[model samples]
Target: MQRFDGRVALVTAAAQGIGAAVARRIAAEGGSVIVTDLQEDKVAELAAELGDRALAVRVDVTSRADLDAAVAAGVERFGRLDLLVNNAGACVVTAMPEDTTAEEWHRQLDLTLVSAAQSIQAALPHLLKTRGNVVTISSVNGLAAFGNLEYSAAKAGQLAMTQNFAARFGSSGVRFNVVAPGTIRTPNWDNQPDALDRLAKLYPLGRVGEPEDIAAAVAFLGSDDAAWITGHTLPVEGGVLTGPSALDLTPKGPFRKEQ
Candidate 1:
């Protein structure tokens, strides 16, 4: 359980939801983490909650300066960096796809894909020394057709980026991987309670994912437990990738149990 003992990690967008869950999981496993997010006060609260093992820094992942400072602060506080969890992405496109402006597209990519790449660049030098790894939070939308076109594209970009980084730095003992999750009950879905309920029916597991669900996968990929793993996308979805009809159960699934 203490797989992260003596390790230090940097987690972006750690104020809430999946990000906070991942940070907590690492800290629970005896790792130190630098938690960053645009919500300064929220991150500060999270840092306080995690006590000495965590540090809170305000980071607008879209801002390279903030990203760099966050990385530096972690290294300064913890000595060395081992893992970078890129979880600072969102679905910002509100307009129709055809009507979406180039500026909006830029903003979307900059927030999701570019931020992840930038964080990697900032953490690479330190990761090299520790022979550490990165675990990016992508989405199933990247693997299949989802309504958020821009977000899906950015998520897909993460997969390719991880693979290339893994290949380029594999010899140096650096690893890169991604966790693609299905619908998770985050604060974003707080207002859409019915949406979550409806989405759950589509999942073979009978429920949408939780932030902790994704967090567990991140822990595995970031720790030495996955020393031989690299450049892979582990879908942390609850069997949704198999399609709801792909299974049989008393409920949640369409297929019935054999008599």
Candidate 2:
């Protein structure tokens, strides 16, 4: 369970949702986690909850300076970096390709893709020192045709970046991989009516994912168990990507089971 006892992990957007879940999971498994998010108070609270094993930093991943400072602070606190979870991202708006404005496209690319690249660059030295790994939070949207065109494109870039890093850093003892989640139950759907229920039906498992589901996958990729695993995309989506949803494929008439 303590796969990362002496390790230090830096997770962005750690204030809530998948980010927070990843931070919590890492900390629970005996890792020192640097929880970075735009919300200073929430980050501080979460850090407090995690006790001294967690450090909070206000980092706007879009800002290179902020990311550098966060990485610096983590190294200063934990002495080295073992994992970097690029979790700060959002689907700002959902629109068809034609309806997506240039501004939105750039924003999506910068936050979801470019930020991860910058963070990796900043953490590279320390990671090299520790022979650490990077596990980025991508999405199933990137693996298949889903809504949010700009977001999907940016997320796809994360997967590509992982492969590039894995190929380039494999000899260096550093690994890179991605966790592509499908319809996770996060705060982003808070205002929607029966959102989890609606989304659950679309998954082959008959239920959507919880943030912890993705967190578990991330823990594996970041742990020593995954020492040989790199450039891989682990779909932690309750079987959404496996095939068609059972809900959508139920037999009708005589083939249908009696209720």
The candidate scoring highest on lDDT is 1
Candidate 1: lDDT over CA atoms?
Answer: 0.92
Please give the distance, in angstroms, between residue 83's alpha carbon in candidate 2 and its true position after superposition.
Answer: 0.6
* TM accuracy, model 1: 0.94
- Candidate 2 residue pairs that clash: none
* TM-score against truth, every candidate: 0.94, 0.95
Tens digits of per-residue lDDT for model 2, 139-249: 999999887889999999999999999999999999999999999888888898698897787787888888999899999999999999999999888887777687666
Cα lDDT of model 1 by residue, 87-162, tens digit: 9999995688888889889999999999999999999999999998999999999998868888888999999999
Angstrom error at residue 60, model 1: 0.7
- In model 1, residue pairs whose N, Cα or C atoms come closer than 3 Å (at least 3 residues apart or on different chains), thus clashing, are none
Deviation in angstroms for 10 in model 2? 0.4
lDDT of each: 0.92, 0.92
Show model 1 residue runs off by greater than 4 Å: 246-259
For model 2 the local lDDT of residue 38 reads: 93
